[model samples]
Target chain A: MSTPKKILVHVDGTERSITAAQYAICLASFYHADLTALYVINTRAMEDLLKARIFLKDEQMEYEHDMEADAERYLNYVDELAVKKGLSITKKSSRGSVHKEIIDLVKADDIDLLVIGELSRIRSRRDEFYDEAERAMRTVPCSVLVVKDEDKVWEMYESLV
Target chain B: MSLIDLVVEDIVKIPMTSNDKPDVLRELVQTLKDAGQIDDFDAVLQAVQEREDKLSTGLENGIAVPHGKTAAVTRLKLAIGIAPNGIDFDAMDKNPSKLFFLLVAPPDQSGPHVEALAEIAKLGQSRAFCKALVNADDAKEVVDLMKGE
Candidate 1:
């Protein structure tokens, strides 16, 4: 395919997600693509937890606030990584269903590529039905890249110089 | 690094004597210098003041995490001071801040610094935890409470 004009990476503070961000940065730098990093605070999960009585109303609020902090932390880390490579990246965060937020950004931003970490292990049929990242990859109009092999990716990132 | 690991007994002060924001900040930074955690006190203070000038680090719920990035410290150093009487730290909620967590780190160590801030935000969610820390009698008690002991 033609060089991607825009790329969006999803980060969630996970090691694999970080590796995915690094891979996307490398790709963006090589292709001179505009990069956007997004962190979706899984409010749907929190709501589900509340519904299941696992979280009380106050607990939900506190957890959401904490999640917001987590989002900023992850996005700032991505910014640092991009700066190290002399690339400026746009950082966006949302509070809602993770996949819905991602797909909406993909459509609105006209992103050419959506890079994500290895689809979280699908342990059950229910997971396949409910996984946000998996659903986003399947539905987004853009091409998707599932980054894996953390060691290789880390090595590649370190070799960027 | 975890908050427990970073905020040891040496830097934890209960019933902090400072009744105002700048004084509290001064006491915490001085505590770190006295503990030999950082040299070039002026450089570290300048870094923190610059960051504070941009925006108050005083979060809601009686918690203020005043952090800075500077070369004066090679690694992350944390100092906690509790003033049960409360000090106005320009918190978003407009409530007096009772817990002060001062973080100083090298510029290259942004990752840990951000993590520490996020951790503080999460911990602030627990009102009980903050209360316990403030009501504690001594620095060792403050450290124990932070350690979840």
Candidate 2:
């Protein structure tokens, strides 16, 4: 494929996803493409928790609030990395099925490439979450780059800490 | 902020002698204390140990990022230990972990804490970088290797 014109990376507050973001940044830099870092809050999981009555109403609200905070922190980190690279990225977050939100965003933004971490390699807290992650990977509209490199994708980004 | 900023000349210990996970952790925590990064070494050490008790932060590729956030530190601090002999960190890969990055952060500063941990995790992926890190003659070389990135 010719150089991608747009790239979207999915981050889920995991180390592997951060690595994937670094990979996406490298590709964006190489192709001079527009880049975005997307974080999906996995509200489905939260809903399931509610259905299971695992947490009380106030507890669920507190949990959701914490998750939102985590999403903001991570997305900001990606933004910081982008700024250090002399690049800017659109930071977007959604609350719903992680994969569905990502796929929808991909179509909406006309992304040419979707950069994501190797989901299977990194263990998700829930087994069903892994299934959702796979489904999103399989259904994305554009080319999908599952970043699995055990090497530094961008030296300069890492140095930025 | 970069990990380099959190590290000083004494924050890194090459050729760590502790053979077990707990001892190695203690040794590294002591290193941080000696660097004047933390005041209550015992409290910080316990926090790290408790984190490890939850789940080993040991990743694949012989790297482990053991981290904790506590009031012991006013800001984010890092201590690196390279055990050439490889300590049994109970890593996911079932391999001995040689590169150790111990991160201590204040409870309020989650951003820098996570950033430092993620940076080390990404750095763990580079074979050449890890190889060079292990081969570096002194703490300065290790710092240079990280800063040279």
Best by DockQ: 2
- Candidate 2 chain A TM is 0.88
Assign candidate 1 its CAPRI class. Answer: incorrect
Q: Which fraction of the native contacts appears in each prediction?
A: 0.00, 0.00
Task: List, residue by residue over B40-140, the lDDT tens digit for candidate 2.
Answer: 98999998887788778777778887877688877778899998879999987899988888988776454345445545645666788888888888898
Please give the CA lDDT of all the candidate structures.
Answer: 0.78, 0.75
lDDT for each residue of candidate 1 in A46-107, tens digit (9 for 90 to 100): 66544433334764675567668768888999999999999999999997877789999999
- Give me the displacement of residue B37 in model 1, in angstroms: 33
Query: Chain A in model 1: its TM-score?
Result: 0.94
lDDT for predicted candidate 1 compared with the true structure: 0.78
What 10-residue stretch in candidate 1 chain B is worst by lDDT? B108-117
Over the stretch A1-161, how does candidate 2's per-residue lDDT look in tens digits?
58899999988766667888988887787789999999876666556544433224654565567667878898999988888888899999998877799999999999989988765543323222234446777899898998776465656456543
In model 1, the runs with Cα more than 4 Å from the true position are A121-123, A127-129, B1-149
Interface RMSD of 2: 13.3
